[model samples]
Target chain A: MSEPRNVKNLKDRINRIEDILASVAAGDMDARIETEIEDDLSGIEAAIDLLIDDLTDELRQREKMQKELETKLKEIQEQQRTIVQQQEDLLELSSPVSKVWDNILILPVIGTLDSQRTQIMMENLLQKIVDTGCTISILDITGVPTVDTQVANHLLKTVTSARLLGAECIISGISPAIAQTIVHLGIDLSTIRTKATLQDAMIYAMKQNKRSDEMKVLSRNALSDEKED
Target chain B: MLELAPDRNFELLGEYAIETEYDIVMARQTVRQFAKKAGMGIVDQTRITTAVSELFRNMYNYAGGGKVLIERGDVESHDALIITCIDHGPGIENLELAMSDGYTSGMGMGYGLPGTKRLVDRFEIQSKINEGTTVRIMKWK
Candidate 1:
């Protein structure tokens, strides 16, 4: 009779373990072998629960690391984008074209001159010429330390481009070193009008503006006199 | 023969490649940082950065592409910042003509090389017709 009773207890414990495993297989990570029977099978059940806990912890850790990696990547990309934007802004700030007078535009270029900046300077000067219908543009380079052959050429191109838009471009603030470099490079600035200082350039531009205004008035008066005649 | 002195305590500040216009801009910014770190004033920083910009542009335009290495170290008795530009492009055939102003194979103002030379305290260039060109410049503080 005792043998039968012990066998019945063993059978009950086995059924409980099977039920717990079935629940675990069905995706219930919370399922555990809760039978209090202190037998050899209990040790196997404890081991299975420990393995599930370890797997769950590992998966959580992997997920957290993946999130951290994604965040770091996003930060790096954002920083790169910001750097690009700042570069563009710096270029724009370095070359500023403004209308200082009624028919005069002034672009005070400071710092070093690069091809890209020169291109931007050219575009800005040309656009200002069109927008303001200004007849004269002055490029002031008082703060510019040096001009290489390429930058000088870009200046020439900018002047020519402005001329095509029916505006005259005058470059001012020619440092002695720059003048020497220009001559050494064999750049012919003879065709272009240059000034020694920004003030000189401004004076010249203003004088031209006044002269044009006076000419317009004179021509209008002459037409009136012709009509009367 | 073009290697930096092994005895000098030199550190690589930054490095960049000249492949496009954007890369030129990046090179300028990098040079600016290095110039600042070397305690160069704003004007000197601008000059160095401008030189770098022109060199990088030349590398991209003439060489098709090249690399620039920025280094800082004590050379001789002076603390200097060194910039090295290397290009695997058609080397200059006539070194003298190339060094002259207004000499360009392209429709450029031909101020790239000579202008770069003037901007730095020390400048050296080596080239072979079919091999490549290397330009090294140093600005001392």
Candidate 2:
């Protein structure tokens, strides 16, 4: 049998080990059993230290990935905001027009036209015509590289809406490739009045303006001359 | 044991096509194959496959079951491929609310529908209360 003093010492040792384990379980990796004894308790301490090391490495990797994901998400949100702001500015600039020449309004579309931009363009153009009381509108598409059915449909809707508002829309400056695409798509643009160049459409609009001006002048002069007689 | 039919237009292959929670991955692969067959470029194929995968996972988690259909449409000179996903289970009540990012009904991050819409050239959605939902997406080549 062991002496009473040795039993007390062993009990104390076990209590110390238990306290260290409790601390470790509470995520205290620094709390380790440091007794100068060659026994099973040392092995337990070594195994626990290894487990904590693995856990720390895993937690560090997780944090790094989380930071990277957050950075990427921020970049994407910034990009989306920039795109939205650009579209808004463009819409503001392109939405208003004064029909100074024979009630004709010109809308020049530039840049790569995506489906969303095309839809916004159609809405802006139609709304402008309704507000300005214009009888004629010209759409120029020289900078567009391609056209699809959805975009073409948006354009068609714009023209139809303009006609309903008692205005005529003339599409001009369609590139050769775009014309081929329109043909291959078999879209019925027979009812639309399309001009090959913006210069041609402008000249046509100016001629219509002159005719209306001449008619007005004739009516006023006839009334004055009749009053003089 | 069942007897085999003499008319054998079907050859046996290692085919494991099923519709379940785990089938989302297969559905995404099917969409990618369809896009490739429709002659999409590598970048576009990747974008479309990612978007479709998002929607397929949503279908598995939210609707529990859905249908996928792929077809080709010639828009002008462009050959556009269309994929449609339809589901009858737990139709979205408020589409606008559902489309908002960070708004989730369960565990998802809620980026599926909006992200899918952004990736495609044309997106169409038709859903009714107590009925079902149909989402049509088109990618132009």
Judge candidate 2 at residue A152 and give its lDDT.
Answer: 59
lDDT by residue for model 2 over A1-229, one digit each (tens)? 4333212256776787678778867877677555555476657656765776787678789999999999999999999999989967875665344454648898887754544566777777778787877778988877543343334555777788889888888888886656654554345577888888988888887787788789999999999999999
User: Ten consecutive residues with minimal summed lDDT in candidate 2 chain B?
Assistant: B1-10
Q: After superposition, how far is residue A1 of candidate 2 from its true place, in Å?
A: 31
Sliding window of 10 residues with minimal summed lDDT for model 1 chain B? B1-10
TM-score of each: 0.71, 0.50
C-alpha lDDT of residue A41 in model 2: 66
Q: Candidate 2's C-alpha lDDT?
A: 0.67
Candidate 2's displacement at residue B114, Å, is 33
Best by TM-score: 1
A129-215: candidate 1 lDDT, tens digit per residue: 898998888988888765655677778888888989999989999876567655544668888899999999989888897888899
Q: Candidate 1, which segments miss by more than 4 Å at Cα?
A: A1-35, A64-100, A107-121, A140-148, A172-191, A194-200, A217-229, B1-16, B29-49, B71-81, B139-141
